[model samples]
Target: MDKKIKVGIVSYRNTRPLIYGLQHTALSNDIELIEDIPARLADKLKTGEIDLGLVPVAVIPQLGEYHIIGDYCIGTEGEVASVCLFSEVPLNEITRVYLDYQSRSSVALLQWLMRESWGIFPEIIQAEDESYREEIKGTTAGLVIGDRALEQRLISTYIYDLGAEWRAITGLPFVFAAWVSTKSLPASFVQRFNEANAAGIPRIDEIVAANPFPVYDLRKYYTLNLSYQLDERKRKGLELFLSYLKKDNEQPVEA
Candidate 1:
């Protein structure tokens, strides 16, 4: 018997299509899958707990030796509803911003936006409590991501879609997450992995239909808002993001 390839995946709705039908595929026998939020997955990959993961691109700089194996990614051309900052006041008026602890990518992206795009440097605090409607006085903003952000968008008077914000500033598509590995994977296995993900893209509606969740327009989120492929433009976006991370003097942690 061959050793199973341990894979870590994010449980966010945006990631639904990417792993669609993976369990039913022939690769399932060789793949041991574990699902968690993006940050945890990245940690697992860093600690050598998981062989491969759908890691946030921001954390790529932190992973000492890694390989990005697949063509598909969690990305957006414009306006990504899931990764957003819900602010009570205008951008410049914000004095303090709450950071989501789930994903480092969103946090890093928000930091880049504040420093480079908006030209405002606010005190960033972590949101220990996932409070959507809790008030924190004047000029307070909350950085929310994943399904919670989807719900928070409704009540948020000032919503900043980070992906769209990045595009508006850089004119490039955003690649939020990608399949990364600490060690080299077999070419055949990597090819099959990409094929499995590609095969799921067109079946977005079906995937949504099977897993119904209230208060979300899954079809619009999947088809209109986000993209699944990691094309040239998105690669440029990822590169630009890495450059920003470099400017911050962030280094990849040796795994």
Candidate 2:
């Protein structure tokens, strides 16, 4: 019997459209799905626990060997409601940031934005628990993503959308995550996987129609905020973000 592909997936609302086709089609039988948060999924990919993953873009540089297989991604052209930084003070005044544990990409994006865009190196601390409120206090800002960010923005005094921030500085879209594999799989399998991802693009409407969000407009989130294509524009954005990441990584910490 042929071995089944082990695939890691993110269990977030923003990823629903990307996984819809895989879940609802005959392709489901060919792949064993492993659901996790973006950060955890990236770790699984690195350790070879899973053959393929919907990995955070920040984790790509650490993977040593990997291939981004699909033309679809978790991205946004501007003002992504789900990936943002909530602060009590203005951007320049924020000296401390509590990073979200659920995402590696958002944390890295925030770092890149601060180091390259904002030019202020704030003290970043990782959240010990899942509570967004508990992690942020006083002057410290909180980096929240996924469903929490959408809901948290309602009460936040200041919200900085990372996608919009990146666009403002670079005039390009931001790709948060993509389908990546650690090993060189068969070409036919890769094509089929891409086809599965493509199948999910049109089904976003169905996902929105079936599940209504009480906090925000789900249709608008899916249609306006999210950018699913991995076209030339998005690829350029990815490359630019990676460049900043390389620079950020090479910088030395203050004594």
Query: All candidates' lDDT scores?
Result: 0.86, 0.86
Stretches of candidate 1 exceeding 4 Å from the true structure: 132-137, 250-255
lDDT of 1 by residue, 100-183 (tens): 878789999998888878999888788766563375347888888889888887777898899899999899999999999999
Residue 223, model 1, lDDT: 92
Backbone clashes in candidate 1 total 3
Pairs in steric clash, model 1: 61-252, 62-252, 62-253
Per-candidate Cα RMSD to the true structure, in Å, reads 3.2, 1.7
Off by over 4 Å in 2: 135-137, 252-255
Give the least accurate 10-residue stretch of model 2, judged by summed lDDT: 129-138
In order of appearance, the predictions have TM-scores of 0.94, 0.94
lDDT of 2 by residue, 66-149 (tens): 798878898999989999999878888888999998989889888878877888778888886787566565678999999888
